[model samples]
Target: MTTGMEELAARMRDFAQAREWEQFHTPKNLAMALAGEVGELIGEFQWLTPAESSSLDEETFDRVRSELADVTAYLVRLADLLGVDLIEATKAKLEENERRYDANLYRGSARKAPH
Candidate 1:
């Protein structure tokens, strides 16, 4: 069975409600929180080389995973407050990205396709 965005969103809602943090979860505030979480996630990789990044030890990996979950939670909360369907929006955005970045043309290339 797959756990979907709805369940995650519900949990986030309840968690925030329980803490009486709804007022602090405005889209702008959530976005900033999300950014901070992302920054924390990035900091985990700050001095790691590519190989080191790919080979994080268990303890560090767990920290990275938790930071990632925090980012997702804030992002979901922001989307929920803004009346956006995260699942549908993600699917649409993925489709758009696929169209904009053709694998045939972009294969083995790190450079983004010019608009």
Candidate 2:
């Protein structure tokens, strides 16, 4: 069965194909675009306190949602072109993190785990 990420990637592929935008969607270009979108998303929260950031007004929240979608679209497209299985990669990374940062050792600590 196709995963949701795969379906999203397929749709993203079709979108670029339809627009003949693949030429502009090279990995580097996509990575840069993703960074830009992340910057926009960050800007949406830059002035807010932590609590305010979590409780954005409706208009601000909508803009945040749009920026997030932009970031995800670029990420999905980039992963698709590189033949990366995002879900599997995420799972593997989570497993590695679990091993590296045991909850009993790292819980409530903001510092990075020692190498």
Q: Look at candidate 2 and tell me the lDDT of residue 55.
A: 88
Q: Report the lDDT tens digits of candidate 2 across residue range 38-70.
A: 999999999999999988999999999999999
The lDDT of model 2 is: 0.92
- What TM-score do all the candidates reach, one by one? 0.88, 0.93
Supply the TM-score for candidate 2. Answer: 0.93
Q: Which stretches of candidate 1 lie over 4 Å from their true place?
A: 1-3, 113-115
Q: What is the RMSD, in Å, between candidate 1 and the native fold over all Cα?
A: 2.2
lDDT of 1 by residue, 1-115 (tens): 4457778888999999999999888888999999999999999999999999999999999999999999998888899889898888889999999998888988877666555
Cα lDDT, all candidates: 0.90, 0.92
The residue pairs in collision within model 2 are none
RMSD of each: 2.2, 1.8
